[model samples]
Target: MVHKFAFENPHLKAEAVSAVVMTDLAQQYKVMSTPHLVLNGTRAVKGRLSEETLLAAILVEAG
Candidate 1:
């Protein structure tokens, strides 16, 4: 879902990290499951979200 969104929005930068390998990084973001989104290194949303909802979060965080 996230990868698709990132692909469609070329301007948006997105990365996927392995929680198993990057344990510290995962802990920093408090990731508990797949598709965890940490926006702007602060705001975060866990679990799957609709594209519209994700976009709203990105816009709010960008502001």
Candidate 2:
């Protein structure tokens, strides 16, 4: 599912959307997160995943 949002704070919105996209993409690839980015359905990535980091994760998982 694709998700999009707009906000007065474009910076914050961009950041949030980036993180959501990463998590969603990760879910699509079945990265094996207990709660989808969470280590054990508890802790999750505290902030947005950088493009490089997201790409590497996707590539590693895809391979």
Candidate 3:
């Protein structure tokens, strides 16, 4: 759903950063907690989030 959302909105670029591969970057972002979502290099949401909640956040952020 996020991929399609991003695809439709070119301004939105969603990506995944591996904690294993991008350990340094993850630390820089302070990903000490689980279920983190970063938008435009800024911390957006953290902890368990539902699909609807996540989509709503993305939409709000995009606007």
Candidate 4:
């Protein structure tokens, strides 16, 4: 979804990392589940979220 969102939005950038390989990062963000999303380096949402919900999160974090 992050990839799709970034593809659709020109100004947005997104990246996917392997929790296994990026253990340090995963620990930094305290990732406890798959499909975890970190917005603006502070806000985060874990578990699957709809596109609209994800977009709203992005907007709120951007603000």
Q: Highest TM-score among the candidates is held by which one?
A: 4
Evaluate model 4: give its lDDT.
0.88
lDDT of 4 by residue, 16-62 (tens): 99988999999999998898888878888998899899888888887
Model 3 agreement with the true structure over 1-63: per-residue lDDT tens digits = 566778888877878778668889878888876667886677468878777988888767767
Model 2 RMSD in Å is: 11.6
Reference-based TM-score of each model = 0.79, 0.29, 0.72, 0.89
Better of 3 and 4 by TM-score: 4
How would you order the candidates by lDDT, starting with the best? 4, 1, 3, 2
Q: Could you tally the backbone clashes for each prediction?
A: 0, 0, 0, 0
Query: lDDT score, residue 40, model 3?
Result: 67
Model 4: CA > 4 A from native: none
Better of 2 and 3 by TM-score: 3
Q: Between prediction 2 and prediction 3, which has the larger lDDT?
A: 3
lDDT tens per residue, model 2, 1-63: 001222432422222223355777556545553323332233443335665664454345435
- Give the clash count for model 4: 0
Candidate 1 Cα outliers beyond 4 Å, as residue runs: 8-10
lDDT of 1 at 8: 86
Candidates by TM-score, descending order = 4, 1, 3, 2
- In angstroms, the error of model 1 at 50 is 0.6
Question: What's model 1's TM-score?
Answer: 0.79
Query: Listing every candidate in turn, what is its Cα RMSD in Å to the true structure after a full C-alpha superposition?
Result: 1.7, 11.6, 1.9, 1.0
